[model samples]
Target: MGGLIFIFVQVLVAVFLCINFMLITTFFTKEFFYTTMRYILFAVTLLSDCVILIVTNLLIICNYLKITMNLWLCAIMFILSTVYSSVTPFTLTAMTLERYVAICMPLRHGDLCSTRCSLHCILLIHGLSSIHFIVDLSIYFASTSIKFYKQSMICNVWIFILYRWQDHLRNAIKTLYFLFMCITIVFSYVRIMKAARAASGEDRKSTWKGLKTVILHAFQLLLCLIQLWCPLIESAVLQTNVKAYINLRYVNYIIFYVASRCLSPLIYGLRDEKFFCAMKSYLLCGFYKKKNVI
Candidate 1:
């Protein structure tokens, strides 16, 4: 059963990775996507998600295979996973704000969401995401003995968290971060809703679409935030029933970690008519051309 579960996860991860790579390829190969702020942000989200999926899956595979890694090497991989896990929410917030600007303040959207501005936003997201990693690293160095860094261990975040206070600190930070993002997304949604009410004709249609997009972002953010509780939930389950805990852990991992990542590509890539058409063309290659010729 465990072997079958492992295979199922690997297959799921492989499918998502392939889809993400296809979307990424379509975005980069086309010059049109580069000039637009939303597509650029979407591409960044896809790229970050791909990295997260790859790193987390690799860690899972290592654990299943009973392969041990040096502590320092594990820390490096964890840092990458942690950082990109953060990047998704920040980028989602930025994307939400972009939609708000486009809908509520249409006149200024072009100036506010220029390619240069979008790139700056990407940098800012990375900068903000790295803060948690930096602080965690500092605490690790100050609190942990250097000898542990040379030891071999299974690569897991808990291995780096040596102290109970570190867990409390992490929980506090996660809660605060989630609140900030939740507020931002809520504010965007409210403003877009108002714009939709005031708009008419094509304008109203666009505003409603933007409003729905913000709602989807909020849903995605909630999914991402739910991941923070999985460890605790799993721990509780483990104390009650080992067999149940095993099943629950796998289910939680797929739903929160793997499925949450799928939301971004689905929300932006598949839903956007322009991007979908381009993506379909790229994915189908000459099929569209042949059909057109017919």
Candidate 2:
């Protein structure tokens, strides 16, 4: 039953991700390059999710065969999850910062959000995120041992998630990284707000728009923290008392995944009036044309 449910969810996520990728691509055509950073991030997220779905299917296959997975694979799985978990916030932060820069520092927005610079920023994010996981995996593997027993044409592998100080170090670093990123995001927005306050007349409207953009970014980040990390933290700290929170945790996670899929389009529609208008006009035009034909 668990395996069936797992596969069901995997297929659901895969299909949803593919649909989101297509929509995002359409919404962020190259002509909208400066504003397409959000779409680009969504594309990366869907790609990462594809990796997750493939690995999850492999895990299900191994379960069916009663084959114990190799330690390397287990480590890789953990890395994939963690990297996606960590990098997503940073990517979101980048999008928020870009919006802030565009609004609060209009004079420099073009220079800052150039094609070459955007490419460099994307590469830098991927490189940094990869390095973080490589260091984590290296430290983890160095301290862990994998034991395997082969019988009945199957390998039963036993893995210890904790080895030496790897778990502790990983937790510490992860927590710090997330905290730092969150703080940076908050600080950037606060400065943008201050800049907005100093603006006059038409600039005041732009500042208000910047504030709205920051709020949307913060809302998504808050949902992520509540859904993904909050439960784990409470579970660890509450120990036996965690049972009381299980219901809320389950609900939060469900909401989180649902919201993640819905957010890219919602945020784009809310922030970019032009894009939203285009989408609405296109839909209305199609409807009228179909009705005329009928």
lDDT of 2 at 164: 43
Q: Which stretches of candidate 1 lie over 4 Å from their true place?
A: 286-294
Each prediction's RMSD to truth: 2.5, 5.4
For residues 57-162, write the lDDT of model 1, one tens digit per residue: 9998998898999988898898999899999988998999999988878899989999999989998989888877787888888887888779898888777676
For model 1, state the Cα shift of residue 182 in Å: 0.9
**Whole-model Cα lDDT of every candidate shown, in order:** 0.89, 0.61
Q: List the residue pairs that clash in candidate 2.
A: none
Score residue 34 of candidate 1 by CA lDDT. 90
Alpha-carbon shift of residue 135 in model 2 (angstroms): 3.2
Best candidate, TM-score-wise?
1
Top of the candidates by lDDT:
1
- List clash counts for every candidate, in order: 0, 0
Cα-lDDT of candidate 2? 0.61
lDDT of 2 by residue, 1-294 (tens): 444554555566667666555554455544663455545654555455445445544554565557755555566665665566555566777777777778767798778876676677777767666755676666546765544322123221113343546556555666666677678678878888888889889888878776776777778777666543654665575676644454443344336654554565566644567666755665677789999999
